[model samples]
Target: MKVFTALEAKNRFGKVIDAAQREPVTVTRQGRPSVVIVSAEEYERRQSRAWRNLLAVMEQTGRYAAEQGLTEEALDQLLADES
Candidate 1:
């Protein structure tokens, strides 16, 4: 990863973006790390993995709920109430 001060990143936005295409770029503010810039492909891959993990957790929870004789409608209502 390449580290760049916020001002430098702002001034050289194109270069930072180009670097992100190859690997992640870290942006710092006030000598502290602030943000990371990643390529779209990397972002999509991470998002897909997150969704897969979330689905696995949901499947496990659903199995447990089913074994407890919980109904789908009741689960939907409970989730809606929380929202």
Candidate 2:
């Protein structure tokens, strides 16, 4: 990964794009990391994997809730108590 300050990223935008195509680039603002620039292929791949992971977690959560006999009303009551 390559790191660039906000000004460097803006002034040398071409280099940033080039670096991002080769690997991820970290852009910082106020000396703190703000965002990452990644190739479109990598971004799409990560997004797809994240979606699959989220779906799997959701499925498991629902299955566990069913096994625990948790109903919508019970879940609502629990949420209300938290507030």
Candidate 3:
């Protein structure tokens, strides 16, 4: 990751974009970390990976629930009871 001050990033916006294409670029404000800039492809890849992980967790939860003899009706009742 390359660090750039807010001013530098503002001044060299094009360079920051170019650097972000290779890897994430960190922008700082007043010596504190502010934001990270990543390439669009990287962002989409991460989003896809996150979605897959969420689906996998949901599948595992479903399997666990099935093994515990939980049914859709019972699950719905439990959720409704919380309201």
Candidate 4:
């Protein structure tokens, strides 16, 4: 990842976007990291993977709850709460 100050990123927005296509870029303000710039495709790919992980965890938890004799209604409630 490449770090850039907010002003520099603003001044060279096109270059920053171009760099983000290959790798994420960190944008900072007052020397503190604030935001990340990344390609849209990369961002969506990450989001999809995250959702898959979350679903796997949820499935495991639901199985455990079922083994513990939780009712269907209660399991549905638990899943809803997690969401």
Count clashes in each candidate, considering only residues at least 3 apart in sequence or on different chains.
Answer: 0, 0, 0, 0
Clashing pairs in 4: none
1-83 in candidate 3: lDDT tens per residue? 89999999999999999999999999999999999999999999999999999999999999999999999999999999999
Of the candidates shown, which would achieve the greatest TM-score relative to the real structure? 3
lDDT of each: 0.97, 0.98, 0.99, 0.95
Which residue pairs in model 3 clash with each other? none
lDDT for each residue of candidate 2 in 1-83, tens digit (9 for 90 to 100): 89999999999999999999999999999999999999999999999999999999999999999899999999999999999
Clashing residue pairs, backbone N/CA/C < 3 A, model 1: none
Segments in model 2 whose C-alpha atoms lie over 4 Å from true places = 71-83
lDDT tens readout by residue for model 4, 1-83:
99899999999999999999999999999999999989999999999999999999999998997899999898689899998
What's the residue-level lDDT of 60 in candidate 4?
A: 100
Ranking, lDDT, top scorer first? 3, 2, 1, 4
Ranking by TM-score: 3, 4, 1, 2
Model 2: lowest-lDDT 10 consecutive positions:
66-75
Question: Which residue ranges in model 1 land beyond 4 Å of their true spot?
Answer: 73-83
Model 1, span 1-83: residue lDDT tens? 99999999999999999999999999999999999999999999999999999999999998998999899899889999998
**Residue pairs that clash (backbone atoms under 3 angstroms), model 2:** none
Q: 58, model 1: CA deviation in Å?
A: 0.5
Quote the positional error of residue 13 for candidate 3 in Å: 0.2
